[model samples]
Target: MQSTRKVTEDIRWVGCNDRRLALFENLFPIPRGVSYNSYLIMDEKVTLMDTVDASVTHQFIENLDYTLEGRSIDYLVIQHMEPDHCANIEELMRRYPNMEVVANQKTMQMIGQFFDISTEGRTVLVKEGDELNTGSHTLRFLMAPMVHWPEVMVTYDEKDKVLFSADAFGTFGALNGNIFNDEIDFEKDWLWDARRYYANIVGKYGLQVQALLKKATALDIRMICSLHGPIWRTDLSYFIDKYDKWSKYEPEDQEVAIIYGSIYGNTEQAVNALALRLAEKGVKNISVYDVSTVHVSDLIAEIFRCSHLVFACSTYNGGIYPPMENLLADMKALSVKKRTVAVMDNGTWAPSAGKQMIKMLEEMKDMTILDMQLSIKSTLKQERAEELAAFAQQIVDAM
Candidate 1:
């Protein structure tokens, strides 16, 4: 049977949700699953936006078939060539033999590299600012290279004022029959996965995202139809503001997040004490996490969300703790920046994790490492109460 939803009077959603996939891109865990959003425009010339992942190819085709209602597809617009969105390209070509593939030079090159498809006479080459007229709806393509991929571009539907934002504003999580952002409590429920998706998947491409945002400012977009998660049909600025802040490496909240790596619980003890002290200083909503237990992707997401961070780790085998080191490496690799950080290290004889963490933070952009550092020998003692109080006080003062 066909499963689909209406986005407007003429456009229909032909996407499929996958809740069985444990991981996104085989990297980040998607506990709530994900959606591969493809749209169909029912104009004089039938147009399909994109295709879903191979895992949901059958469902996607069914949705397309129902939406078409015996009308032949005229064009298949290739937005991003990432395997997840382009998995059914060859299959679709075989299904719609007369349908033309609309994409840029780079996308065409990639299609050839990924599949053995003959695009000799069935390709509609487009570039930035190029328009395709399909009766009432006119689509203007805008180049958004490196937003996630080199061949990426977004289409602007002039009539409905909808921006087909490929993966630019997409998030992880399947739409549980709720297609639009306003249909759910996005801030409370979906924002966590959304932040994680952006921080881990597209976080490294902040500069490219900023460039895309700049181009979007010129267009009069009423709805944003992304390739994942929910569509933005209302309060578009709420999501747009988040994208702007995230792309600029700005914090969404002025809160503190404490991540610690404990070998035998001593370092975790110090982290607990510090967290309590910071909370006592009137800091609410402080997050505490065991770096060894939590996924590094989740840690990266928390770091991106919080304005302040505290890394507590124990030295091991004359080096920083392995778990904490992994978290720092992932953070650096994802281009995390613009946060105030405090360091704490525990060791029986020599503590180097704090110093090593400070060095790593220095490599990132605009990171403010606190001058006050805490070192613990085996376990924190009541004798060092003054020092701990002073360290916590410094964090409070900074905030």
Candidate 2:
């Protein structure tokens, strides 16, 4: 019943994976589900890092109980107060009556806001550089506000060289027995979801993330125990580099991502032609997506990954197509920038989506809009071969 993994000799992963949840935060789609990671440190003074979602409370409890082995919890660290990670706080407090709820002022306030828990004398209020000594392991708390939440903070275990990264460096995937990042091909399998999670969930807080990264550089973090996703015990920089790049609004790849919106598939067809042209021109890793079908989160993820982007959309009611328009809004809201973008629009009579899209893109930071704006009337005709070739060449040249 106790589905747990050992992080270190004394630190046990009392986390649980949820494969049933279709959506994370009821917005972003999590087809691979997600993991709510909590850790239990068996030291002279027992400490529970955090709690999992209510969906997997039973398994989390079992894991916690089994790891504790009748030893009462001494301290419970509240890193990020998001409901997914804090759902079991009250339940945990009820179980461990003497457990000191260790958190910052904001975190303590948020705890009271979320649950009707009496923290009269059981709360251990800590600040930015506060240290919590649990025997040989000394945890130095670093306040990482708005890394995803206001009350967010990461605990660094001085003894083990491990950083208890709350929601930072986290991904949206359930751990399928392999709890460590080295156990799976993260780049091939989990990178997309990780990008999506960061882009959609924490994309808006890039500045905050950069601040946290700056703080992290000073610490010798050998292991990263995130509140979600896989534990990082090896090649920590491999992931840390990703966080650094992503938070800087920098592209992960120099490849192109073509996101299209089509009503009767005309725009899609045009996008396909362009994609083929780009591919033929030796543009590798070209991704073509129909905005109507592919989730916007996935599109955002691809946008974050690729350096070049092409938006092909059909005009609807003298405006940008709904899905494509929605995606553009999301991009602007998430502060997506520092990339080259090409616009293509299809219209039966009037083509204004391209113009409107360019207008929207202009509002963003440092976005280079391609000069060759391809305007398709009803459909892309064979006569437009030279024009399309030139357009594709521009993208190729930009690369």
Q: lDDT (CA) for every model shown?
A: 0.93, 0.92
lDDT of 2 by residue, 110-153 (tens): 98899987899999999999999999899999999988888899
Off by over 4 Å in 2: none
lDDT of predicted model 2: 0.92
Judge candidate 1 against the unseen true structure and give its global Cα lDDT, from 0 to 1.
0.93
Encode model 1's per-residue lDDT on 111-208: one tens digit a residue.
99999978999999999999999999999999999888999999999999999999988999999999999999999999998899899888999999
For every candidate, C-alpha RMSD to the true structure in Å: 0.9, 1.1
Question: Which candidate achieves the best lDDT against the true structure?
Answer: 1
Q: For model 2, what is the error of residue 390's alpha carbon versus the real structure, in angstroms, after optimal superposition?
A: 1.7
**What is candidate 2's TM-score against the reference?**
0.98
